[model samples]
Target chain A: MGDYALEVTNLTKKFSDFTLDDISFKLPKGYIMGFVGRNGAGKTTTINLITSLYHKDAGEVRIDGNRAEDDKVLYKESIGYIGDESYFHEAFKIKDIVSIQKDFYPTFREAQYMQYIEQWELPTDKKIGEFSKGMKVKLMFAGVLARDTRILLLDEATSGLDPITRDEVLVMLQKYIEDGERSVLFSTHILEDLEKIADYVFFIEKGGEVFCDYKDQIMEAYRMVKGGTDELTSELEKEIIGLQKSSVGFQGIVSREVGDTIGDKFLVEQPAINDIIVAFQKNMGGNHTWVQ
Target chain B: MKIVISNHSELPIYAQVKEQIKEQIMTGVILEGTKLPSIRQLAKDLKISVITITRAYSELESEGYIATMQGKGSVVLGRDNDLLREQYLRRIEEALETAIETARFLKLSNEELIDMLGNLIDDE
Candidate 1:
């Protein structure tokens, strides 16, 4: 148990080829956290462990202060989750799926469901198999929204949805945040999406946590310093956690503490989340950072 | 409101957002009192952090381009186009001054600079 809507401590899960090593993080209640990583960066594995699909080899997972294993069904009841892949019955109509969810979530809102169905224009009568990937995503989201769960865990929820559908989902998620008690832990490779709504961010690579901080903290603490390659001596380069050189020059992440060290010769500017991700990977090695 | 975002632009995310809204207000894409998207919506649309969008909106409001109301979201304030144009031109002139200084430093002659400008305009 931890002081968060969701908390995982030293969670490790191993498969034949991949191992999620000692993963840990926290999503404080009411904050939307973007769980960021490249594909195969253990984003899905972490989500699975949280949802109790895969038992952790060693770790503690608590949702709303209850150990996830104490009462798996009750713990799941307080959380609404959408996996990286849709898991509804192929033969079920969107309406049928909604009904099934209604049976499960005590706090399910029929009116909200109706409104979302109308807002998203989801074809309720159409079988789940007949829905386009985007439509299926909408259905999944609408259903989740109706649950009114205390915490929402989404794994790549926007991966395949069209831009419009993606925005619609974001709007609905924002609406869900109206209570100020609900929280979300969303994992995705799309840094752009995280940039949109995430108040907190956690970056996972090679099965361990790499970066975890408030969105504003990251923005304020790190900067992108651009300078001519010749200007970047090893001493100056060491001031930056990540550095990359191009034909034009060099760009890298420098802590604000090192600003005076680098001086005014370089263009010091804030780096985008995507740029930060790339810089973090470069810091690890020129190759992909997380997966071996 | 014709908003131009250079995908390769060096401007910060907040600055880009501020400029886009400024353009919208100046060009009438967003009329005075027109309700703009919520901070969350703007962030999603721009694919930027809420903090970034919040800074942009706050800066815009302070500059009189927009006003934010609780629950109502940000709204355009009907800025004077003349004011906006003057600001835009001043920025361009400053950039041009820097460029001219650089050109002079590089010893580019008037004729060579004119030829370069002509080629650049033609490409545009």
Candidate 2:
């Protein structure tokens, strides 16, 4: 009914130390939004809240126009979630797990499941614990792909995978959303993969949202400015968002507008998503120091 | 046409796609009336999002490099010499702008910079 496959409005959760402060964004149907953040940046917490594994302290999460909290079964059925760790019992075989999943999800297609298993070359009789980490991840993907799910919430699903396997998975994700009725929220620190496949980006830092925008817009809006230390005027310093200083020069991020005002005094380069995130983290007074 | 995207490059993925396709079209690598892959097919092949491919294709269509038909996929349009010349000139101007800036920063004389350019051209 709604254009957005997944929507979160002012979602918040508090812990003893960190708080996910008013996280909000929407994943439009048929697009992938890369969810990026540093370690312990509440990415998992937000994913947990969306899956209804953790009750939200405030706000709402809507999956395909259904309230995630009110319609738990429908919400859960709509989303195919894959986390960093596998939750299957160690003694369970792949076939056993598939049968169990079919019972829980009415839309699960056994033929599709078998097709994926054959395509992925996963062993049906192999014990879950006997599979390698990569094999386990593939198994998880195979299960999710066989279900008629509308939304996929992947939390660092590809980190354990090799480069070749990761590329395959990325291709699989692209194919999954080809129908124009599905959406994905993929959370990972691998900005390169995001650069390849993500239409939009949602960046978080220390449990707070930094920004959310179309990937191309972000690339055009922010620039990496580098210049001699002597050229760094107080006015220019004031314009930068994430300023890193060294004896030779100062490098920082500034909007294209501010970059225009500085003119040729500094060398301006396009900022990657990784660059933007690192700059923001440094600006937040995180432990990372600018290397150069 | 084959397009390779570099994630580490300064240009955005869509920009890269647009530029590469334009290059192929200008060089006649992609002939007129050639049927380019559909957005979904290209996205799947490149391991990129459909929206990104759509953006690139839309830009190409707007620039007259490609045309989209009703049910059929996009087809490469006949080359426009003026447009191709303009594209080449813009690239040369960008390169010269950076070259001039660096030369000025190094306090190189106009004659010296010209001589250097001449030598490089001769060598090439």
Candidate 3:
């Protein structure tokens, strides 16, 4: 097995209008990497490429050292994908889907699947179409966890779920990676969900990778500075990014070094993941440096 | 030990974990030789990434707050209360320096600052 559970190098996919350009990141073993972006930001496209659902125009996708193009069956087997929408037929009952999965995946565990079914309190006899959205998500999670998969790729899996159900799913993910052998790459627009579980964050913007680093390092690199309009100097303006002004005051984000240079002149506070994303998007024209 | 995390806070999650655990140890709520949860166990319990828990534990270990044994989990180590007290005092001093700088910027006199500090103590 490779040191990284999932690694994409210069993954490029081109559509008529949008291009996923040179996207690259690594999800190390036993870590959850949060893939964050705005809607239609090529997140789903990248995930599709990783799963081999969509052919790449260029670049390599690797799962445990097996290229997606080189070993299609093994690469697919090594990854479990849960997308926003259900892939199973609505007419199939839970038991029917279980049997199908058992036939398809060599490592599918019937006992483990049943255990998760019991834990989730899902009805085996009920058709998938009759299940609620949250229940469907739970069922999908149960199926994914029951398999001996090394890497999980989730695409907006928790978007519409209630807060409590979302928290439960996050806890389940935490438990799944306890053995230090599995890894997760989850793409979502919800920064709050990632705040609780992500070790590394890979942020995509306008079809390009803007930031990729550990969550702690990202938190330490940017500072949200707020001050009166009178405090806005030309030098400071050059240093600040995504500067916004209102009738009363102004606010912007600056590098930690720049914030320190300004000293007590402006109020420097830690920027949340949401704030950082917003500011970074606003300052999209600036050079994008990949933070380690 | 009971620990709380605030996403809105300025501190990073690992820093918050380290501080809360250190506080518990210093206050004697968690005694010396107490076995802390394994990194994986704590991460699962907290619904966070194991890497984050690992970072916190590493920081705690470097500070001599905990010791990890091979094939076993980490345990709390005896702390020097005097050293801890000194650390806290230094933090307070740093905060006070900022406060003094702000006060000077606001054109507050030394006597007025003293009076304000006195009033704060009395109210508490």
Candidate 4:
């Protein structure tokens, strides 16, 4: 009913040790949003809540502007989930998965399913257990795409994949949203994948939202600052995030606006996604009030 | 049309796409009525997000360099006189940025650089 294909507002889930606190983000139709954080950063917890696998303590999730509570069938029809683990039985053959899919999804297209199977070179005779990690990922994608689901939720789907397999997965994600009718929420700790294809990034830290913005804006928002250790005075240290000291110099992530105002007093360079994430972890104690 | 993207560049990926396409269109390297690669096709080829190409194409459409017909892909527009002038001016700005960078590296004062430019032109 809205432009967004997926919307989660104030989504919270609690467990004994951890609470996924106030996780909120929207994936607009026709785009991919990388749901990123380190391991134990609640990335999977948030995905579970989004898929309604876990009961939420608060907030709601809407798929295509319809809540699961409001329209269960429609919500279910709209999503395809690809977890890091194989959903099928280890003994199940490709045809077994296909038959199961046909029973579950009314929109399943057998021809499309077979086409992807052949295209990805997935063997029909082999059991799921015989498949390599890349082959398993392809098989999962083969199932998900055949259902013609409009939104895809991939949780750590690329972690164990080799580089070539990851590239294949990235291409699949790009292809999925080509029509501008679909969206994807890909949760992974792998920043390399996110950097290549994420339209928006929702970075979670310690069960809380750290920052969410367009991928371009995220890259442009901060700078890596470097200077001699003395230049990193106590007063100056307050301005930087995750400040690090060596015998020769110190380097840290600094707010770009602040970096600019400080002029050339420090060497400011562009930061990679890894730099930003690491800096966040290092400076967690120092208050990231500056990170938007 | 050919596009080369450099990760080291400060220009965002989308902006790089837009500028390159704009340059090609203005210079007639990409001709009028040329069908630009569909957004998805470009993204796959460039190994970038579809959003980046979408942003680039939309910006191109808004700037009147190209037109997107529903269901069909974008196609370049006929040249405009004012737009052509603006494009040429952009080339000069880019050239000057390089010149300025070199001058600064050499520690040439702004005035000295301007005087050098004047002397070179007068000698020509």
Q: What is the TM-score of each candidate's chain B when compared with the real chain B?
A: 0.59, 0.67, 0.66, 0.67
Docking class of 2: acceptable
Arranged by DockQ with the best first, the candidates are 3, 4, 2, 1
| Span of ten consecutive residues with least summed lDDT in model 2 chain B | B79-88
lDDT per residue for candidate 2 within A109-218, as digits (tens), equals 88988888888888887898998888888889888988888899999999988998988888888888887789999999888898778888888888988778887677
Using all chains and alpha carbons, the TM-scores for the candidates as numbered come to 0.69, 0.80, 0.85, 0.86
> Which candidate number has the best DockQ?
3
- Candidate 4's docking class is medium
Give fnat of each prediction, in order.
0.29, 0.79, 0.93, 0.64
Backbone collision tally, model 4: 0
Indicate which candidate wins on TM-score. Answer: 4
Query: Would you list the rank order by TM-score, best first?
Result: 4, 3, 2, 1
The segments of candidate 3 whose C-alpha lies over 4 angstroms from its true place after superposition are A287-292, B79-124
lDDT of each: 0.76, 0.86, 0.86, 0.86
Candidate 1 on A1-292: residue-level lDDT in tens? 3448888899999988889999888877656889987788899998889888888899998888888668877888887887656678888986676677778877888888889789878777777888788877777777777765778888998888778877776766665654456778888877777765787888888888887887756766677788998888887776676677898898888776676456577888767778787778767654323221
lDDT of 4 by residue, A1-292 (tens): 7899999999988899998898888889989998877889898988887777788999999988989898778778888999898877899999998888888899999999999899889999999999988888888888888887879999999988988888888988888888888899999878888888888888888999888888877787888888998877787788788888999999988888877766578888778877887788777757776355
Off by over 4 Å in 4: A261-265, A290-292, B58-64, B67-73, B87-124
* Tens-place lDDT digits, model 2, residues B10-93: 777888999999889988899988999988889888877677889999998877788898769999887664554566688789
Give a tens-digit lDDT track for model 1, residues B22-85. Answer: 7777677778878877776555455555666678889887776777888778877655545455
